[model samples]
Target: MLGPLAAGAVFFPGLFLVSKGALRVLLGWSEGDAVLVSTRLVSSLQAVMASSAGWIISSSCRDVMEDRHWLTEAYVLFATPYFAYDVFAMFLCHWHKQQVKGHEEAGPNGGAVRAALSGFLRREVLMVLHHVFMVAFCFPASLLWRRGKGDYFQGVLFLAELSTPSVCLGKVLIQYQKQNSVLHKVNGVFMLLSFFSCRVLLFPYLYYAYSRYASIPLLRVPLVAPWQCNLGAALLWPLQLYWFTLICRGALRQSGRRQKPPGS
Candidate 1:
């Protein structure tokens, strides 16, 4: 556990610095842009690692409830530090953007730090809460709460990250003012589909998987399952629904623009 934690501690920041430097030198991106892109690049890499681990664990577990995969615990520990790193990375990105926008020019350095922090927290409270819960609640629950059962479910949960790369790509495209490009449009479609299928539909699929295994009806599985399992799913699904609605709205706006007559 300590080993993976130490490795992640070094790896994420190292990769971020390397990525930031490369983007600055090779692409001539501004500090703010490089910070933002590097953070997203790190996120995409983590998503791939988590999703691959999920796939491997999920595929190997024949018994959904009883089967155990060694990678489940290993990968979770390795990736745990990423949540903390990401929060700091996000703040750095936000701070650089504030500088780029000249918000810091109006205030002393100390004041700018406070203002940037406050603005970042306000803008990102939901996401920050999500990360906090993962580190505070989900980490122990994943490793300790289950008493060594249900690795399959955890693997499936990790698989929810499958949408992240597309989401990252879409953000980068928009940041670069290429939202009208074909790549952005194609990526938007992919993001919507992946987010919906992997995230929004995931909880239901978990219930269905268990119901089939237990020989119970789909709706009844929730009642029959452990309270903790039901509670976790209940807490998580609503967030996915909310995010999905936002994604849908974005897709609709993009579609509306695409259909606008030339020259408006």
Candidate 2:
């Protein structure tokens, strides 16, 4: 498993590199901007693959996903490295953008490209925190998974990322200024549906599953146990809810404008 994870870590940057080149040549996107979109597209595709497999294997368990410690361990073992890769990749992109920003200011197009990349990075503050938490906690837990207490609980948390593909696609479409395209419209609709299903509507059920299957009831579970793993899990709900609202508003506002047509 670690072998596959190591391979994945090695290949993640390669995926970013290939995708960035394709976007730049195919779409004439600036290098920094192309990499920004390519990175999300690649990450989103990986999320779908991993989460889809998780959901399927989880479905076969005698009970809910939270009851499958092995499955949880399997996913975390595979996913944590990619999460680490993401943190490093984002940091590298940031540093590269900063180093070139002053030189690139000579051209207006270059400045806009840099600004677009900066805007995307700024919007990822919460996502950066989310990644940091996973790397700091989930990665280590999965490594020592055999001795861990909350294995099943963590499996369920990873499933919450199922909507990420749509979210990524929606952002990429926006970056390309494809607001009025039919594909963009369709992707927006899916983004709203997936966001609600995975991030918003499914959360209460996740909590219920935790309460039902946990060794101790969720409320009774001590936050300090497992060295505050429970605390990290408990706090993610507010972040999900906040991001879900943002998704909904953006989707709805765009859909409305899409219907209005130009010069109405």
- Give the TM-score (vs. native) of candidate 1: 0.94
- Runs in model 1 deviating more than 4 A are 103-108, 262-264
Question: lDDT per residue, candidate 1, 1-264, as tens digits?
Answer: 788878888888899999999999999977778899999999999999999999999999999889999899998888899999999999998888778677444334776789889999998898898899888888888899888888899999999999999999998898788989999988988998899999999999999988889898898997788787777787788989999999999889988988999997
Which ten contiguous residues of candidate 1 have the minimum total lDDT?
100-109
Candidate with best TM-score: 1
**Candidate lDDT values, in order:** 0.89, 0.68
Question: What are the per-model C-alpha RMSD values against the true structure?
Answer: 1.8, 5.0
